[model samples]
Target: MRHDHHGRTHRLELDDQSLRTWDSTVLASDPEDGLVLDRSAFYPGGGGQPPDQGVLLWGGVQTRIVGVRPRDDLWLVPDPDDPLPPVGTQVRGAVDDDRRSLLMRTHSGLHVLRGVMARDFGVPVTGGNMEPGQARLDFDLAEVPAGFKESLTEKLNAEVAADRAIQVRVLPRAQAYALGPIVKTATDLLPPDLEDIRLVDVVGLDLQADGGTHVASTKQIGRIEVAKVENKGRGFRRIRLKLVD
Candidate 1:
């Protein structure tokens, strides 16, 4: 399977992160199996980001998509009370701009955090999770410098103000792995047989193998506030961040 195709559904979001709405044909629709589309921009959740939520409009009715089940086929889970578009039905798919845009900014902001931490503290991210406007990353830091939280907040905002460009690219497996040690995770989780790899680059900051949507630049992330830093023991420190207006 190609990296851009999820099962039979052509994943439009992979190439166009800014695309919010598009026309598609319903390929399969089952009450229990969920719906599949010939083309979709709804991002299937992966790499610490959640799947997108939106609606499919057809025949003057709206079928609300609540979640996604990524499998052999990208199954779009719709709201139980909504009507389903039958196979071969033409429909208009729309991703919730507010939710997806915020997610893009938040995901990019986390990369900024990763960049700053790696550049300054030289630590690898152990784990992380994110929502629309908030995120937290765990790092394997043996010691926290004095005023570490304040220092990190300042550095994070500085990078945001820098407006560093974010670029996405797809490369052959060997070429991607050749950029040794790009995966920021404490453990490399990429599948062995995957022929193509998708990479997200916070230009001049951080680059990693990722499969999530992101903003065009760091400035699009807005102000990042380091809300808290908690010591999780065993040389693990959790840093929480919030995006402010």
Candidate 2:
């Protein structure tokens, strides 16, 4: 969502099994400006999921990619004082694997909670975001009584225990719009010129149009600890959760 969809590279997360490292070539580079690659594995920040960081190795040297911005094009910005790979240079990009794994689990945990809320309580998730190991989701329901969150937490862990497989696919815009995903925030924001939609399905559980990276299964999300519940007013409520052990 940060850059024009066309300017972004083929998302590495879509491959499901290809998140470890990426090999690419420098498409554009400026010592005082930033770097652009022919293709990149970094997930440009969007959908409440922060961008990924790692190192780019070239000519026996490593440049830490501190962050990325989508000004005009997807720019792979390196940390100041770090060497920048020049245009036409061959580079190997490595994402912070541990951080990425934790984020994937946290993101998937939020999706699981959303699915259970809809399936059992008929409540829809409104919005939320995630940090490294924790996440939160908002719901349209209000004035929930005693033991409501306790029961919800129980159901959330049940999904993880089930170890259901996670599936990802790119559907045509028309067909994707027809599924009526439980969450529509991301899909609804896609630029009109976007031809295909990315869908993440938690097997027999939940499905939504999501652009963020996620684990391959519910079991990979680990156990979720309900940290707090809040009344956001106007019939909005929030559940904060974290991945544990």
Candidate 3:
């Protein structure tokens, strides 16, 4: 299967073996970076997060990998007409760290708020967006009171101030099943066979089967402010939030 880490770490550096794995493509000789790996950790714009872009280096040539997508396997596509490096060639792969860090922090921040909403308001999330510096999530709630939004804002800020640690781990499918029905019913994802399940836990705040990168701790999320709430009818409310300086 695909060796993925998009839901695990924010920034990762390549080592000897991993680097070799990335430079094995020989199909695009006249290519840009000419680097291609059997599997990649880059998130290809799924579940509301956008695709990642960065540069790959080969023989002093810096080629831009504009987009990453899953084909029969995950193919690292460089600019148009770019050739692939000869198979057995070694190249370096790098992700745009600044943009990746933003996604990681913002995505974790949204989850922090999500867990808080579930605990305090008994509202379940209907949908959400994990964007850079901006995020929004919808919940199934009766009616929105004027003070509710402000109250939530204060609560989420406190959670961030708590500085809780965030942890991610891989779990066997059966081992994960032992955690109980609460989580099993929440996600439709299954570990390939029984060894590919990955679990993301926010210490005491939240736990779920997720495949996205996140901040190491809640404190890194900074100040979360509830910007607005939209009533979408049928006890559905959407909350908009932003990071405060």
What digit string (tens of lDDT, one per residue) describes model 1 on residues 1-245?
88999999999999999999999999999999899998999999998999999999999999999999999999999999999989999999999999999999999999999999999889999999999999999999999989998998999999999999999999999999898767999998899988999999999999999999999999999999999999999899999999987
Model 2 C-alpha RMSD to native? 2.7
Which TM-score value belongs to model 1? 0.99
Candidate 1 vs candidate 3: the lDDT winner is 1
Query: What lDDT, from 0 to 1, does candidate 1 have?
Result: 0.95
At residue 124, candidate 2 shows an lDDT of 70
Candidate 2 stretches with Cα past 4 Å from truth are 1-8, 31-33, 185-187
TM-score of model number 2: 0.91
**Per-residue lDDT of model 3, residues 109-193, tens digit only:** 8888778876777667777786677888888888777798889888988888999998887666787657743241224544456
Rank candidates by TM-score, best first: 1, 2, 3
How much lDDT does candidate 2 score? Answer: 0.80
- Each model's lDDT comes to 0.95, 0.80, 0.66
lDDT of 3: 0.66
